[model samples]
Target: MPLVAPVTVHKISGETLTEVPDLLAVEEPLEIRLGFGPITDRQQRSVSVTMRTPGHDEELAIGFLFSESIVQKPTDIISCRHCVQDSQKEGNVLRVELHPDVVMDWSRLERNTFTSSSCGLCGKTTIDAVMALTPGPLSADFSIEPAVLHALPERVRQTQRAFAYTGGIHAAALFDVDGKLLLVREDIGRHNALDKLIGAAFWQNWLPLSQFGVFLSGRIGVELVQKSWRAGVPMLAAVGAPSSLAVQMAKEAQMTLAGFVRDNRFNLYSEPDRVIIGQVMAFKA
Candidate 1:
């Protein structure tokens, strides 16, 4: 079966009602687990279960672990696989085996890692809770012209294969300064899409993505900004407006942030100096 599910929908326009077949982005829960041993004894524990699209389960799980600061490097993970523990499994549980030498911090695991469609460092008191996980500043050398920023939305739209089919998924793409699409991932959860992208990069030894910029098909949220910052991405552009917290993180991290990038127009929320306006032609939309 395709990752996207086809369903019948009733459309009501003016006074006429018609039933039509429509595609929906599939949503399912994936349980991420950790397994490790001390040469003689073995251990297994469940980390988190998040609602996400069906594909890229390993990438999603690894990305979640890295984003949440559970693990920093790709080598920290020994391997990943599907595990069935109970009747509810249905191939939805994933087990990530860490290097035996690595010590998993139970305290750092936090209270809970379960995330719904909308997830982040929740139940923690203040913004500082999120800021505590913030990564260091990114390199200031990599840059793109303001004109290129304006062209990104359309360029990214050209590669949204899943969104075209379902019209119900969010995409997160990585692009070079010249506006070339490096990678893109789509998911029902916007954050999950980004996680998959970052996790793929992590597995490919593509960390410290200092020269790359991220483009999101949805509004910029706090967790999205935090995740991008943690991954060392210097620039982030979103199709919709950014939340106040997202903007605040951008400023503190000194990362370039843009939003509402449509019709050749965009709003630079932070680190505006990073974009070189003189290099390309920029027209207001």
Candidate 2:
């Protein structure tokens, strides 16, 4: 489906009002279903229904599963595709079939209720619940220069195709230590955009993304930190500020977190050693 839709709006500038054509980021519900269990006794269940921009649905589903700790590796998924039961639900439903040998964990599904595009951890019961699923502290073997971090926001902005048109979408981008953009994903939801980026990397067997950094188009939230940490991304920078809980979590995870990463300046919240200044160093990666 198209990521943006045409619309007409009345523009009011000063005393003049004029009708102009515009574009809006499309928001729609995507139901992600899981197919698991042994080959002889397969079972299916609806896990998540999220409102998101309609593009890269499969990546979003896989990324969501990975971020939730439901699926660990790319091989864990046997297949992922759109499977509509009713005609009314066409292009809105997706199914991910897991390998038969994978053990099922239904409790994880209970933690997530209905997810909105704006918030990812809406139904999460507590911080402890989220921490339980979080991975261990990242390795401090990687480092990047402040100049590389400053270049991320503008590079991400240039690649935001949907946002360029609608001016109403979030983005997540991956970059190497040298400031090279690897991948970018756009969505109506900030979390969803990160999920899609992670999902794409997961499909390419790029988990344990220790050598790369993830840059967000919005503020750093606890959930976003958790997701990036789960993906093994040691460094995260964003165009906006980091929440208190997000900074706390980043410290606990041993991850480098930078916020307000625009206009040649950024604030490091944790693992500041990874970002070197006034010195030249080599990264372990």
- Top lDDT model: 2
List the global CA lDDT of all models: 0.83, 0.88
Winner by TM-score? 2
lDDT of 1 by residue, 173-281 (tens): 9999888899998889989999999999999989878889999999997778878887889999999999887888788788999999998889899988888875556
lDDT of 1 at 53: 86
Whole-model alpha-carbon lDDT for candidate 2: 0.88
User: On a 0 to 1 TM-score scale, where does candidate 1 land against the true structure?
Assistant: 0.89
Q: Residues 93-146, candidate 2, lDDT per residue (tens digit)?
A: 999999998887777756642243255553233355666776667884889888
State how far residue 28 of model 2 sits from its true place (Å): 0.6
